[model samples]
Target chain A: MQDKKQLITIKGTREGLTLFIDELCSFNEAIKELHDKIIKNKPKKDDPIVSVRIKLGNRYLEDDQDKQLTEIINQANGFKIDSIESEVIRKEDALKWKEDSKIKAINRIVRSGQVLEVKGDLLLIGDVNPGGKVVSTGNIYIMGNLYGIAHAGVDGDRNACIVASYMKPTQLRIADYISRAPDYESDGVYMECGLVDEGQDKIIIDRLQVLSNKRKELSRFERRVQNG
Target chain B: MGEAIVITSGKGGVGKTTTSANIGTALALMEKKVCLIDTDIGLRNLDVVMGLENRIIYDIVDVIEERCKLKQALIKDKRFDYLTLLPAAQTSDKTAVTTDGMKKIISELKQEYDYIIIDCPAGIEQGFQNAIAGADRAIVVTTPEKSSVRDADRIIGLIEKEDMKEPPRLIINRIRNHMMKSGDMIDIDDIVQLLSIDLIGVVIDDEEVIKASNKGEPVALHPNTKSSIAYRNIARRILGETVPLQSLEDEKGMFQKVKKFFGIRA
Candidate 1:
């Protein structure tokens, strides 16, 4: 049994510690070995809780095998043994996190009647066609041309901004306020649009105009009153 | 193996019935044994569009409930040798046909026919579920208008939830080229971009479609009509033929040109 312990290996991952059960031993014996190893490696009472993942051979555990494993896990101390069914759990969790962190898109063109709604910041790798919409809770970033409606700061985050390679949106909304494109043809330039103030009370469209005039106006008024 | 295709649009009046009728007819014309099931139940119009409403003595409900045989309920198309219509019961509501009934009927039909085309009713209700219950693929129909496209988008999302092997293709119907060109209407690119689906067909807005529907004749039967041509082209594409999409802009003739000159837009 002491030499049998050398066959099994344990390593830690993002989710929990992975224990590789050796194929040489019967599934029941492997479960016993795993339980004993876990008991010996149990962390001190002051240490943080550690989770464990049991990895059986290529063949999936039978119903009877799972029952035996569960009994072993219950008997073990200071550690919880979880079965790693597939690699999908980790990948899906990562994908969910990626989706929540930012809105990433590789669309060639966003056509009319299409509404693309993202929870976080939106990053589109293509053009937003007329009548299409991109709504996000955070900042909106378009790698290509934007010719449709884009609403940033959907959850009322005033610091949110809309950036595009060619910023020619039909209508843009940041926080609460919205601004429509000028009627006449304007100089085609890559631009960023956002609200400069903390509360996002004003809408400003600028081609590299870092300090919004609206913000300057408020500050200038405050300075004059203070001097007086 | 026979394939089941569901034709659905979440919004009403976006040409789901019309597309179903035309596509089924076109498939039949191609000599594929096709059965078109109208899953709209109480509000069925596939029978009317296919010119078999008067002939529907026994409906899908009667067949599923074992009140009548499946053969007794199936109405064969007079014009097409390979096509049949399973009309929905006008007297009974959508609940009359359950998803299990639809799955069993479609499975039974799959053994006999090359294609089973379900004419899904508008809305993502029990009727829609019944229609898509055994569908192998789906074709979503939408118009250029905002409401129709929005509904189509919703339907597409629902179809995705079904976890079908293939994504549903999009059919943008009733596109008025003159209106689109004048910037008065939503363009095809915009619809495609928003839906993010492969284009199956684009049906132009034609007065002849209404005329054909009124006469209980599908527009696909009228080969000379532009809408008919569009339907036939869609059918050919469904048959896996590499056919170029017919340009809706090409139908803008002298009258449409005159309308444009007069600044009149639809």
Candidate 2:
């Protein structure tokens, strides 16, 4: 009884019941404990289905072990595994996450018919000529004129924004929303940013200053520098 | 040994054939052995513009398909002993010539000529691909119009993406003084800056160019017309000369002075 109690703990919260597997226990021991507890506390047949989440605190499970843990919880009557989360991740996944968060810098003109794409954020230092297109999964920062098409958050990230030194793009897309430039001429002096407005349900082009207000995370470095 | 320059414009009726004829003639007149290859295939007009239409005994298709030797297919220009023309086949389509065949033929011509000017067809298709296959340099020609500039931008993008030796240069053709003054036409500076390429020359719109083309003579044959001077300047620039850009105001001012001398209305 003491060993089983030390191996796993079950708690109920507003979200659902959570099964906290002890990090110090062996994989086989935790699986056994989880199976016993779920079977012992199985809800009555008339009771509603109880969604349970598993928390692997500081413990990493192989694919088969993770599947085995889920199978044990799901097999119990009236209970299903909602999610399985671990504090540790695979090295390849960590590297991919790092890469997706990194900003790619390109210095060249995006002429007509040319398409420039990046997996993460993009920092373009040259003009995007008419007929050219730029696509990124994250935010896009252009230090030159944008007279073509720019699509930010191509993977459907609605929070992604596109900022350009000259906001004369023919079309701007953020996530699922697309807005074409009006028939007005830009003075080509002030910078502008295109961001999605949740309430308005369309992209709005505003001054560059609005970027800091909307995307506070983008100014984290500047904030840290100022605080120091 | 020699440089092959492809003159391309993504849109049609923007004077690609006229530019090729004039530039080839200007270069040949400068004492360089120049070969003008019309790669328009079915729509071949460079030979017609160069007045060598009847002399084409064997066209480029015959040369590429190995039906005739490259020397036999080449028609020497009637005026300039050094200038030559390899006419496009009037009957065959663009698919008849492959990029590999073009590379082979261009390599052979490069060995014998100082400059090989290829006149590319309009639109970004197999014809464009075949035209630019063996060229070492590219000259994108455009006019002062929204659609023309847009197409020129596309052609420039295609050329640079191919990783050519140097970036393609720009030639803004058919610039009108009155339309520019009235702000109806796109400015030369705007086109150059928008395309973001080097500006080789800007040819003013002149009726003399049309007359010369109708007569099967390149305007560059006569050195006096504004259009002819523009083509000659472009040819010189191709030869690494540092000629100054021609100003529209000078020509307009000269016209105003002529009107005053003739006692015309102010």
Candidate 3:
């Protein structure tokens, strides 16, 4: 006979029942104690037991451990546990990580004709040449030359910025606005381009500076162009 | 050593079948026992290109389903002693030849032939899959166009997913050198940079290729044609020779330009 306190600890929350076991207690012992407790604390016949889940710490047990838990829950009398229903819920929750935005770092030159689409920020350590596309739902950061077409904030976040060491892309799109490299003179040096003021509609192409000197020149250029 | 090479282009009208026929004839001329298999099933053209359509009584489907023996189905090339053709079935669909079926047939033929070149069909469907099933290496054919390069890129990804031992080589076909030099066409470096694959061959756009194909003989079998020379160089490169890529700029000189303008015979 096992001690009741060493067997199991059951807590009911809005989501479902969480069964915990004390330190040094095997899963088999916990199962036996859970069966005994359910039999002793039987509620009204109309009120049914909804679900039972076991937790050790943060990570959930998979494969055989999941099977063992399901068997224990199904064996309990006066309440039927639909193992398949609970399994589906568990699987959906397990795959939640894939739905969240992730940062994918590609460390090679993306050649032309290659299309790379990611739901989060994309960081490339190499060049993105012509015919190659890098599209992201979030920001796009390239550590090397950006010669290909890129679309950042594809899901419509206008604040998204496309930053590259050398920006000479054939086409660039931020949120909704699309801009192509000027056909006359293409500045091949290291630069950055993003949305500026006036309803965040205009694209400002400028060199990167730590002390904001380029920002002042950009503003001066904008004012002169507007006044002229 | 024998190699199983598949000539594939994901998009249609990119000259995959034409390249395969020419390359097979070129390799056969080099004294290699080359067997060209048309895995396009119902849309077979390799037999017609090789001018052996009348000789193909038993097709690849008949060999796969054990209806006929392998040797009975193989059509010997009329021009080359070392060349043969395995025609695809015009009556059957793509499903008639599965990946496993292709593997079994190719592995059996690998022992006899010095080279087994498969002419893959267009698209990334079951026919394309079956065509590349038993290949030791692959050559993706593409024209100097955006759509062709895009499809070739997708096919490269699919080939990588199959876990091939080596990267699939690229062959840029039908390049019009004058257009490229005049900035109207994409350059070789542009394509090589975009596809990110090693280039094995580059064939110039030539009228002799069309004329020869219409005559049921590949341009590669023709003596002194530019496209034929390119195909022979490609075969030598496949044999591990260090052949230099022909400079399109150098070939655009006064005489060559005049020849190109007049559609002069090579």
Which candidate achieves the best TM-score against the true structure? 2
| A81-115: candidate 1 lDDT, tens digit per residue | 56554322345656655554544665655655567
Which portions of model 1 show Cα errors greater than 4 Å?
A1-138, A142-157, A164-191, A196-200, A208-228, B249-266
- Better by DockQ, candidate 2 or 1: 2
Write down the worst ten-residue block by lDDT for model 2 chain B.
Answer: B247-256
- Which tens-of-lDDT digit does each residue in A181-225 have in candidate 3? 887965675766554334546656655552154234332323322
- Per-residue lDDT value at B78 in model 2: 88
Relative to the true structure, how large is the alpha-carbon lDDT of every model? 0.80, 0.89, 0.79
Per-model chain B TM-scores are 0.93, 0.95, 0.93
Clashing pairs in 3: A112-B194
Q: Order of all candidates by TM-score, from best down to worst?
A: 2, 3, 1
lDDT ranking of the models: 2, 1, 3
Chain A TM per prediction: 0.46, 0.80, 0.48
Candidate 2 or 1, higher lDDT:
2
Q: Candidate 3: where is the Cα deviation over 4 Å?
A: A1-104, A108-120, A127-138, A144-158, A165-190, A195-198, A202-206, A209-228, B249-266
